[model samples]
Target: METNLLFLWGTPRSMSTAFLRMMLERGDHEVFHEPFSSIVVQGRTVVGDHTVTSHDKLLRLLEERARDHRVFVKETTEYDYLSTGGDRIPYAGRHTFIIRNPRSVIPSHYAMNPAMACEEIGYGNQVEMARRVLAATGERPFVLEAEDLLDDAEETVARYCRHVGIPFLPSALSWQPGDQKVWSRTSQWHRDAARSSSFTRSEATYEATVDSDRFLYDCYWHHRPYYHVLRKWARTTVAA
Candidate 1:
């Protein structure tokens, strides 16, 4: 059984990929980028170069691999795999989450997938999964706000490492700019991240966004409450 399986779940456009890139730079842990997403979204088993064909098989593969290596997984929670209700998840290791403002998330998501469903706005599913993980594990998943990460990449990641009982590696914050095979399935969504060498927050304009687009406007309100649910628990630089 894999005891070091760490999951980093987040909503779409939440800067979660950038965080995963940092993990890859760490040179430790066997990382999988949205591995379960193939089964849920594409109906395939492709995860980088491997194809396990089913959630059960994929989970087992991860478990088996964890015996000899530390495993880290980063996934967007828009698919509701966690909401389906079952013992499908391996609750043994750590489950952590990251969230971004829906005001920002909705517009960015619309830019990529205009046909995206409200659920794909994702804060709702993200929070629901966190709740389920909490119920199963008896521990609230560590939540990181994108703002905090962008504000201080070094400190935020250091905090995350401590919370998960891992060593803090300042070198992981920046990496070479290139396309990684693990990101092959959804390269377009990660264009900026693919070119970025570090955590640099871009200026996202909302002026002509939600107000001009009715769909995104609704999406923001629909998921804003859920975003706050996770946001309240996220690590911030503010003093308690």
Candidate 2:
């Protein structure tokens, strides 16, 4: 079995897709892209896709895949639902969460699903998701933000190596954006957000996204102290 089975959970537009891309490029570990976790939000209905239904069967399948490898990454950010409901994830190794600024997150998340509006689930849902994962795992998995990864890809990969206790390899720095690909689960709304394009929000949208900042902060105080420190260093370097 693999020494590590990295399970990532988060909402749509949280850069989990990009992480999938990056992990695939590592060229060593076999990454399972959204295999076991299916999107089922309100309990009665499921969303997006469902190629398989049996969790135990799926887990067995994954274990077989991990039998010989050193690391296996399973990504299903939509599994934030299970975490939020106080469920335990039975898997080897640590659990991690990839996060983006909820300012950017709200618009993109709502765009993927306007039904996930703050008014319905309350603004705190995003941060609460992080809190729940940490509480359940009781391990502070590396909190890698999209901005930091984009700013320094090499350092970001290195951080992953350090956090997961893997040997730091430079190969992760340059990965071929896979040629023959699978596209069933990807959505146009997310593809647009994945770009470096600017989203000019009107006052109404801005108000809605910004109003949730407090709730986000409350849910993820674990990130704020370090975030502020990094932000200050970033500002000084950029200003020079």
Native-to-model Cα distance after best TM-score fit, residue 166 in candidate 2, in Å? 2.6
lDDT by residue for model 2 over 1-240, one digit each (tens)? 135556665445656666665566567766665554332422321212334344544454455555666445444443443444324443344665555564565555554565553433222333454455557666434556666666776776677677667677666555443331432344463353234222212223444343465654343353344334434433443343
Per-model TM-score on C-alpha atoms: 0.91, 0.62
The residue-by-residue lDDT of candidate 1 on 172-221, one tens digit each, is 88899998888888999998789889999866565436778887778778
CA lDDT, candidate 1, residue 129: 82
Candidate maximizing lDDT = 1
Runs of candidate 1 with Cα error greater than 4 angstroms are 46-50, 83-86, 204-208, 235-240
Clashing residue pairs, backbone N/CA/C < 3 A, model 2: 10-77
- Report clash pairs, candidate 1: none
Candidate 2: what lDDT?
0.49
